[model samples]
Target chain A: MKLNSIHSITSSELNAFFEENRQRTLCYLESRFPVLQEDDIEDIFQDSSITLFLKIQNNELLDLTSSLYTFFLSICINIARNKVNRSHPTYLLSDNITDSDFEPIRNDKLEELENLVGYEIAEEQTDQEYLNWIEQQVREGVRQMKPPCNQILWSFYWDGLSHRTIADMFGMKSEDVSKTQANRCKHKFSDFIKKVIASYER
Target chain B: MKDNSIYNEQIDRFLKGQMSTEEEQQFKTEIGQNPELKQQVREHLYLIRGIKQVKSQEEQKIILQEQHEQKVTPLRRNWIKITSIAASITFIMVLSGIEGSRLYYRHEIRQYAYNASVGVMSDFAASSRGTIDEETKVHLTDLFTNAQEGKDLAETIDELSRLYVLTKDEFVDIEDDCAYQIGWFLAVSYINDGDYEKALEIINNIESEYPDNEDIKSIQKQLVEFLK
Candidate 1:
């Protein structure tokens, strides 16, 4: 049987289609961005899915010519780039490396055509929807925790706030944030996973 | 110092770049030498990264679509009443009930596709083994080659049923991948035999096993009416 293009799918059809492809999308995202933790990957996936769903609902798919996978890849890449930018001002001092030297995929000055094409194909295959779904689930799980847990998580990760700072913010003993966050989130996260697995098992 | 509250606080402080120089140095040392703490830091950092990239372009479209739906057919106008009524009846009678059943069955047909996927993987492994097993190869090739060549679909379908049973038994101990590989073959064979029901049964089983096989679902949906 031939697989049809995503364009022919109605909004409802697209929802079903995205749900089915979620796993493949997550696998592809994880493979592409090994730097991301599993939880982080899942949050990104949720965001992407919400975006895709909204886009379909609004009839905002402007360019019918672009493949769904390609459009999603561009979105995921941009999202990743945005995250990197938000996290830190600079990865490191440029030092000897000049601006022209960091040309992304082209940075490998001696790259062959086959390698380039292979990279493109790999990018094309990455499923942004699945990644977004997983990311959303993790975020939701985190949100259910206490404020201290939430603050510990966000401060440690997003804000890069020190444990002492988090403690000061909460008026708690500074060193307690890490232990508190981990202890609180782990069981809740496990229960969340159990729920997901149960849904799939059915 | 006795409480270790200062050190406990360092976990978040060092990770977020908010610790004092001495505290930061201590945290880095801990990170370098302590595996569990390092892993925790990595996971937390990853979560933050993921949360930051949640937005996508699809959202913009859905918002626009909502606006269009509201504006295109303004309320209190009753302008397209006749068309709307007819469409509504058609949708309820046909699309809602009957089509819903078709969708249910379509889900079932996906199983065949999953089985077919698994069969394909085994075939690959068998072929890649590089041993010259002519008789086995010929038999396997014939199974596919003759699966859909019959004039009478009923007879073909019966044969497909037997083939599915045999294939199912063979793959009992194997992974779902084998089912995926051989599901298409079974599906096609049943379609040829005029046993769309049996074909659909296999498809349904695979669909339950592998919900993501959209290509199989589409094909199964197309065949539902044809076979019936």
Candidate 2:
């Protein structure tokens, strides 16, 4: 395939180009999003190809300085990002947190953490076991957390939503407020885990 | 915590390729200095990659559907016209005491089976899985490509049948979609080769195993009618 503008390429050539890249693109997507269903992956590939074709037809590729595949990749990434954003809302603040609300961990909570780990301190546990314990504790704690706080952490950590987007979706006064609240919730969750460990040592 | 968020935001920008060259260099320096920040950046990158995969798959589906429609519609319309004309010609030939109408119908049926086989092969290629290694993947891809190109279909059918037999015991390890696809392709290949008995046998087996698989059931029905 000669490297040139999209305008010079025939439809058949365009289709051929897509056909050649189709399997490669699918493999790339599969490796990245192994969690996605096969049907969903196929859907994204088809959608991206069509978008690329349309862009080429409309002379949109003329402005693209990178190779055609790179442009196609960007389209795929943008679409995936948007889909994730829509499906997973990050800032569903059922409980809001503030810096002023901070409190020291209770003695009992630390004891609970120690008991859960089956050790005097977290360092006694294997790295994998320690991480798993923390994950389980965090999950349990988040469930009991106020709505927005759990939602904020879930969105930021799991869904990977940006603070600005979280703020807009959750009706926060500003991105700063969302960020601070998220930070507070994170600290609170960590504090719960620490308290549990601390009580074990005491 | 505030500084962490700032670092996270910078990591996000870096991953998204929104950062300038100088900013990206600075971000790299920060990551090198802070192990936690580097880990956070890696996690964010992984998440974004997954999202991209999902998005790309969706786009592929749209493109394939449009291509299928574009390819099938004209052929279907042309088939209708050709069939109508063939039917009229057959009527005239019958009236003229020509004994060739039977042969014509058989040829038409064979063509239909061939087209159906091609369709089944396409579906199989689209959903085929179960390759445990790169060599197996390459082999399967070659077989499918050859089959799709209408090259040595009998060999392709044998390869597919062998694969089915090899993987039959590991059904739990293989996805149902992939298993069904293999059976569908094998049955279709039999139909195309005019092995109605073999086709019916495979179809019946698939139907028994996957009663809810509409594609297999539909193929079984078509094979039954064709055999009749």
Candidate 2 lDDT score at position B147: 39
lDDT of 1 by residue, B126-206 (tens): 432345366644544455544422223345445545655665785445333334545656676664443568667877877
**Candidate 2 whole-model C-alpha lDDT, 0 to 1:** 0.48
Candidate 1: chain B TM-score equals 0.36
Model 1's C-alpha root-mean-square deviation from the true structure amounts to 22.7
Give the TM-score comparing model 1 with the true structure, all chains together.
Answer: 0.23
Q: What digit string (tens of lDDT, one per residue) describes model 1 on residues A50-151?
A: 666555444455322233444554465556555545664464423332222111111121111112122111222223223223334554555555565555
Off by over 4 Å in 2: A1-202, B1-62, B65-132, B145-154, B170-172, B209-215
Poorest lDDT segment (10 consecutive residues) of candidate 2 chain A:
A96-105
After superposing candidate 1 on the true structure, give the runs of residues whose Cα lies further than 4 Å from its correct spot.
A1-132, A143-145, B1-46, B54-228
- The i-RMS of candidate 2 is 24.2
- Report how far off residue B134 is in candidate 1 (Å): 68
